[model samples]
Target: MALELDGFAVLHRIGANRAAFEGISSEVAKVARSLLVKLLKDKRTGVDGVRAVRAALGAEPFALVVDGLTDAEIKSIAKRLDKHNPVLIDGDAATVRKLVGALADGSTEPASRPRAASRGNAKAPKSKKEPTAPKTIARVSFKSAGATRGR
Candidate 1:
């Protein structure tokens, strides 16, 4: 029977029929299921299957998949899906590996050598100025000569 569905359901159907999603670790599947469920609940059912899978696996699990699976197997799966739907590979293998390494190190920033100073070669130590005393203004007050001024 034909059914009109999209997103994860379509992926599940493909997996069931062609076994395209075989060899995916249970941990990765669990993460994918959770993400898919959230997406479905949010009414975001239009996401591409390949992109959703990549996002669900994230950098770490995607790296594991690349390391564990053969190129032919990966290509076979992509080819099957590509025939019927759009396939989007997020980044190159090197970029995915770099992201995995960054995640493992608990850092989100990409690794790069420290850059040399752009302008001044050496930075001078900043000097602290001594506090100055507050200046006081002189005030003059005159008393009235009362009755003596009239005399």
Candidate 2:
């Protein structure tokens, strides 16, 4: 912001208003939600993941990097930022951690990890559990107050 203010002053001083664009650079900034979701207390590490985020967003991140910062503090900051800037700021620390992880480990939608094929058979795992529910009791009450036996 300070840099922007200084640049604006410089532009106005030199009579560069007419040439100036109404907006700044055009980078589509995703709210930092996904990147922040990468944060994990167990995965605390260097700024490699943060760098990946910067590379992805094409904008310098307004992030709480997990270099020396504690996970609790980062989580608090993230929540607070969400509260303060409901529209703009959004991040899940787990995502930030994952970004770092992908940066270090690399990315691939590898088909080698076989996904389970859905079974058309109703007897399969999805439907099998449905039959385990408690059996409901049905009661047949007499219509007449004094009556008891067969109708």
Candidate 3:
């Protein structure tokens, strides 16, 4: 009898195949697959949440199946990981450990605080000086200055 596997199962198999091609041990690949499945199954961290994890695993010197994770995404992932919030899955200590270990060398570092622009600090600061009344000018009549309506 043939066993039927779902889309995600197929994807995991593909990932395992790729890992084998890249010389990654089946055990590490299995751990990565399980971690990915856990993350995907979680309600909070869906497809978007998996992005950082995928990027970190697929980064240079590892180069797993998933690639093309941008620097911004990496930075955002690092930032999230740095927060150390227990409420979120990414912030969970165990998940983080798995993620770091899956990176092949645990070289992925948590990103520092984001830049001012990222933190929404781009708005100009409000002026401290009180508003002054508008300067008033004497009205000048256009007719007196030889300015006519028609040339």
Candidate 4:
């Protein structure tokens, strides 16, 4: 499945079986969720699979390498992740890893695009105004009577 996350293009491919853009498979979805639950303890490595998938969405990747798993394994994981969400990537593991590295190294711009106003209307003109200083609140103090009695 193809989706966007954290300003990155995400492709969640499932298992060895590739599916058309119809939707997610039930079995794949369950397995992917299970893997996520198991790896939740370690966010960095656990989420590496998904991150690798994110890399594939970039225009160009920096290197062709994955951190823990082999390139094929990571691609397989990407497939599994696709079950939960559509991850549409037309690249290999190396491409994905390179993109991931580029993002981390700040070599490439973030995946988020500058969104245009969806309203299809031009922005209103801004009126110039003088900057005003902040107002300070005055404090009031009252002394309590030493002795007080109910009448």
TM-score of each: 0.29, 0.19, 0.24, 0.24
RMSD of 3: 13.1
Please give the CA lDDT of all the candidate structures: 0.47, 0.42, 0.49, 0.46
Candidate 3 minimal-lDDT segment of 10 residues: 61-70
Model 4 — TM-score against the truth?
Answer: 0.24
List candidate 2 stretches off by more than 4 Å. Answer: 1-35, 39-45, 60-71, 75-151
**Lowest summed lDDT window (length 10), candidate 1:** 79-88
Quality of model 3 by C-alpha lDDT: 0.49
Models sorted by TM-score, best on top: 1, 4, 3, 2
Q: Candidate 2 vs candidate 4: which has greater lDDT? A: 4
Taking the candidates one at a time, how many backbone clashes does each contain?
0, 20, 0, 15
Report RMSD for candidate 1.
Answer: 13.8
List RMSD in Å for every model shown: 13.8, 15.6, 13.1, 17.4
lDDT of 2 by residue, 12-105 (tens): 5444554354353131112223335554322543345444545654443323344334555555433332233222135455653443334333
lDDT of 2 at 9: 68
Instruction: Write model 4 residue lDDT over 1-151, tens digit each, in one string.
Output: 9764642122333334455633667755555444543442233442444455445434232122234446665555444433232222577666655554544345643344335656758687799899999899786554554568869
> Order the candidates by lDDT, highest first — what do you get?
3, 1, 4, 2
Residues 77-136 of candidate 3 have per-residue lDDT tens digits of 433444542323335444544443343244543344545545565777877998899999
Question: Residues 1-151, candidate 1, lDDT per residue (tens digit)?
Answer: 9976687676667557655556665654677555643443243332244345457667665555545544444434333333232222454444444443343334543234346656676677779989899888776554553436544
In candidate 3, clashing pairs total 0
